[model samples]
Target: MLILGAHYRLAFTHSILAFSQVINAATHYQLDYPDLALILALVRGGSLARASQLLKVDVSTVFRAVRRLEAALGQQLFEKSRAGYLPTTLAQSLAEQAERAEQALEAARIGVEQGGEVISGIVRLTCTDSVLQGLLLPALAQFMPNYPALTLELSTSNDFANLSRRDADIALRLTRTPPEHLVGRRLADISYRVCASERYLQSVNTTDLASLTWIAPDDFLPDHPTVSWRRQTLPGVTPGYRCNSMLSVTELVRAGLGVAALPDFLIGDGLRPLGEPLHGYDTVLWLLTRPDCRALRSVVTLFDELGRALKLP
Candidate 1:
């Protein structure tokens, strides 16, 4: 009886160990193929609502795919929140490679088909909201008209798109150096200034940068990306009103609520640009891609066209 019990215990232990191995493999194993990339793209697109609307699928379907993705990978891609699901650390890291691979495959297909080789796909592009509005919109309008067959999948988020994980096929980043092992170009300089509505400016406490309330990102968390950005750019300045929505911030600013740092593109008819830029700060927008697909004809065509379209000169 004791011998029998020992054998059963050993069997149970082996089963448990095997299960753990399977879980680990799903979480850490490198991902390949386009379906995973597409699902990942949808998740990266934004909130579940936004992703669903953009994907032109039911939110329930998106949720199902998300569940299946998690189940198959044996890992949680996002942390559940009342607002929506937020990506996890693992998701952030892995996203770049999947994005790059997806890009490579598409480029290969495009090259093949355009040269009598088979091809058809959508290109995933990631860029800042500011860049998308100010620059990319016009460029895309022109590019799309020419390539009626090609689809442009654009993802605009404050989060840095991970090129290595394949978070984006092409990314317009406001940084000098691209991620390690990726190829990129420092495209142009982006500048921002404190702006306010004339009505609001008239009622302000002062025109001086120091003596006024401000519209800024919420600083509830220490690691908040926007807070970090604000601190780096405007240290010692306190944010009077903090909110997450860019539209909200702009609307508040437009209502003459307070002076806020805004990009040149965000400066519209009702609002006005301050005399001086915020701390005289500027960021470089970079065009990034994986080294593997750098030489592909389709990739080259995109880079050449996009580069020309986004030219500063």
Candidate 2:
């Protein structure tokens, strides 16, 4: 009984020492604490070479920093294999925490820069080609001069900007249904009309619109309002030219390739409206922002300005 108790006491003391070492390593890991950026770069870049490129550092520097971090933490943070350096579970958790910390830092920095009085900093705005070129640019010509400290980054894409990912501060989307996660006001219903160049109209019979060769959006964009409306309204009509880009379709129509459904804003470029505006093709233009984005002073100011400009008669 005495021997067993002595062995148990020794084992218990050894376990305590091991636990203390772990705690010391965690608390005293000074090099690891500030190297959260390095950790995130490594995980996101997937390899030392990639990480070095992303961080604009020498590969040796990245390797040394990671080595120091691992030594300070007293554990392996990644597994090296033929594929690449895959982050361990601990490293994954650290990267997530680092991301959160980075976001917080950015928010604080933005706040300090704005100083509550000045409406400044970059406001990323996304929209389709027609909205960006036709409507928003003209409004911005007046809006930007008034806010000299503000910077606007415009991204034109057909795909909806993912506000949840912070892809853009604001998005001008043409849709009947906007995503529920975003908050915004519908600006106005964008009108769509069938248009053809004067040169094309001379060749094709205007009386029988269904018999004319059409310039259509590609099958990939079956959900586009113009594409869907065409399919439903004009049965048995096929396109002579198919394109995925609305801007390209407009250019094709202007070149007299075929008649296409186009927005009213684009009609002045040597393309004449065919008939009355096509039914079921008009979609509301929405100015959208994430809940967090709506709180930013610069974003709020720009959002309101864009809303007013778009709603004007």
lDDT against the true structure, each candidate: 0.64, 0.78
On lDDT, the candidate that comes out on top is: 2
lDDT of 2 by residue, 10-78 (tens): 433443343334333445654333577888899999999999998899999999988987887787889
* C-alpha root-mean-square deviation, candidate 1: 14.4
Residue 104 of model 1 has an lDDT of 42
Q: Each candidate: RMSD to true structure?
A: 14.4, 12.7
